[model samples]
Target chain A: MTKEELKIKIEDILPAATFDETGEWLNILIEAKAWYGFAKQIRSSRELEFDYLFCLTCIDWKTHLTMVYHFTSTYRRHTIVIKSKLDRNNPEIESVAAIWRTAEFHEREVYELFGVKFLNHPDMRKLLLTDDWSGGFPLRKDFEDPINMIRL
Target chain B: MIEEVGTTTEGDLIINIGPQHPSTHGVLHLVITLNGETIKNVEPHLGYIHRSIEKMCESLTYRQFIYVTSRMDYLSAHINNHGCALCVEKGLQIEVPPRAQVIRVLMDELTRLASHQLWWGAMGMDVGALTPFFHAFREREMINEIMEETCGARLTMNYMVPGGVMFDLHPNFQHRVKKFIEFFKSKIDEYHELLTGNMIFVNRMKGVGFLSKEDAISYGCTGPTARGSGVICDIRKLYPYEVYSQISFEEVIETGGDCLSRYLVRMEEMRQSLSIIEQLIDNIPEGDFQAKTKAVLKLPKGEFYSRVETARGEFGVYIISEGGTTPYRIKFRSPGFSNLSALNHMAKRSKIGDLIAIMGTLDLVIPDIDR
Candidate 1:
């Protein structure tokens, strides 16, 4: 499907969805409150069935956090990038693990490094970090570790 | 504390396998819950070698960061570096020369062949066949020699630069690759006779570690892992980059959706990689190896993502540039990471001995997962 047709179809399902066309794929920016609802709709929607969640990650912008979810339908073969803005101080977003099983690992990695809490995630503990780790979110912009991390 | 570690309310046995186990091949830990011989749950404990490459990339410039990627999936090092370079090229809007494009593709295929060869040997070893390991390495050594001659490194050949390759190919590159292909082709049948047709191997692999098509897609498994389940998730065919669109190679798939099917996918993939190398080994275009660019590279403010079919699966490089020398944020979507996620789902209700075969087929590289 062409990007134009996808935009038109996505518009019907998500009226409040803001589109960013500057990048490669059709980028959609939605609020954190609307992420799970929109994700569920797209997964079940007849035309825009975003069944495959290929990549899921969080970008810490220091002041706020942005969750990037790259989705594509295995059958339709078109790709889209969906983003949700979260307040960095208390970053929380609905977990899509139940919908896309791959999100279980990706979300857990994001949870530990960025300190973003995943709501209703089946397994919500540290993934790549050790149990004794107390270092503040290593991927955050303001993360400081004088001894371990080499600062440039 | 020791007693509490193993026994649950229902009297299930908990077995801890390697941060150093031979079967694991790298630093991967799994705490498996077992009831008699069947596995109830498999919980993976990672982070033993987590260097946080993403955070490290935030500090390095566009040129410096691409080299560090080879350390992640060292098996598919060239492909990982190529993916990173592709992302930077996308952001910079640089057109790689036709010759460089062909060279890059050839290197990618060779690397894929080498990676699969190593995986083949290791998979055999994991499944308790030791002789196949030596035979597999014999073919892989030729590719390593070619890599060392042309790229100056065998494993982590950081040969890819943003615009194109760091330098032109070696004088004997084509001749050596052709020689390796001919040598590998003759030994192909022998490999089948040795391992693929063995009666013990067949019984151990067939109908074990079953992964359904639905579950495979949901877990985001890619490369042979997903193609084994008949999902048609080959990034080379789905989203062709470089000279891949021009090449005529099959996206090998097997419908078994078991350990045997996954094994067949990689075995066939090695042949496809050879056909690709054969097609382009002599057809390399005559032109500049790299495009003209400034020494100090800078990317405009935007987001760029590039995907390449690595030996394990889809290796993606996502770069968020803030109009600076360094990338604001970078994320590598390693194929092994996603493929490893589906391990527990496939291994449930399977015997403990079958776990090795399942992991062998999955081809989990711990560094790629923990990176």
Candidate 2:
């Protein structure tokens, strides 16, 4: 199925979700409260299995954080992009690591780098960063490290 | 003396297999808890070669970041470059010309063949078969030469650009590729004669490191590692990219899920990749080599995810753009991460000697894992 068809199908299921057609895959922006339920439905729905949670990551957008989940159904050969806006101060969400096993490490990575908490994650430890990393959320737009400087 | 000899209790022997050892391959330290000859547990300690490629990509322009990915999986550098280029193209909404797509496919297949050749040699050496190492390297050298002639550097050839390739196919590309294929075909019989049918090699690998299909999928193993367990999860076949849709090839699958099965699958995959290159070499398409795009690329404020089938398995590059030349965020979903996850599951019931063979068959390149 094309990105347009996937978008329409997702919108039909969850009316409140917003979408951006500019990116490569179909990007559907969902409210934080609706994310968990929509994810479960998407997984169990026969029309869209989305069995593979290939990539799950978080982007810190200065003002707020955006949680991105890249889903693909091996059976249906379709791709969907799910995003949820999170409060920049204390981002938290229910972990989907239980549903798709591949999300275990990815969720932990998001938790560490963006300071987003995966509520039920089995093991949420620092993945790529060190224990003494004092730089707050390195990927955020506002982050600055004088130790690691750059030339303009 | 009698008490010491007869009344002794057996304790597990702990052995550090790497972080510097030759067989561990690239700064990987495997702490093996052994009960005599049997392995009780194998714990992998990583992060030695972590250069923070993802973190580095945030600072580089979209064009410059492709070179950084080349360093991740150094063996299949062309495939890595192809993947990053494809993601950038997707992000920028650029359409590559048909000829460029075909050339990309050709380079990808050659990279696959070269990677499998190195795997074959290294795997054989891991299982105490040394001669196949030279044989494998002999064939791999041809591929390296071909890559160097076109892309300049052998291992980390950043040949792929966003709109198209760095350059068109070399004038002698077709001729050299055809020669390599014929040469590889003639050497296939020698591979079988020397190693595949050898009695000693079979005994060492057969029935070792068995992973059931259910465990393989649940753990998210991919590439030949998962295919060895009868899982048909080839990203090239399932999610056709570039010119893979145009060509026909078999996804080699074996049900044994042992060291021998993994070995045979990689061998068969090498043959299939050669077949693909043979089919693509003669029919060079005539068109523009690259797509037209702006000098400075500005991706719309959003997220883009691209999954390409690497030599390992499903390799994903997720890019988040915030209307800037440099990506706001980039994440690499490496195949080795999942493949490495299955190691403890596969090695729990195996012997110490079999651990090397198991690790070999998984084909875990440490930099890719640490990245």
User: Which is the leading candidate under DockQ?
Assistant: 1
lDDT per residue (tens digit) for residues B302-337 in model 2: 666677888988888888788899988888888888
**lDDT of candidate model 2 versus the reference:** 0.82
lDDT of each: 0.91, 0.82
Give me the chain B TM-score of candidate 1: 0.98
| Interface RMSD, every prediction, one decimal place | 1.8, 6.1
Superposition TM-score, candidate 2 onto the true structure? 0.88
TM agreement with the true structure for every prediction: 0.98, 0.88
Clash pairs of candidate 1? none
Write down the worst ten-residue block by lDDT for model 1 chain A: A143-152
List residue ranges in candidate 1 displaced over 4 A: B1-3
Maximum-TM-score candidate: 1
Per-residue lDDT tens digits of candidate 1, residues A1-152?
78899999989988899999988899999988988888999999988888899889989887799999999899898899999999989999999999999999999999999999999999998889988789889999998888886346
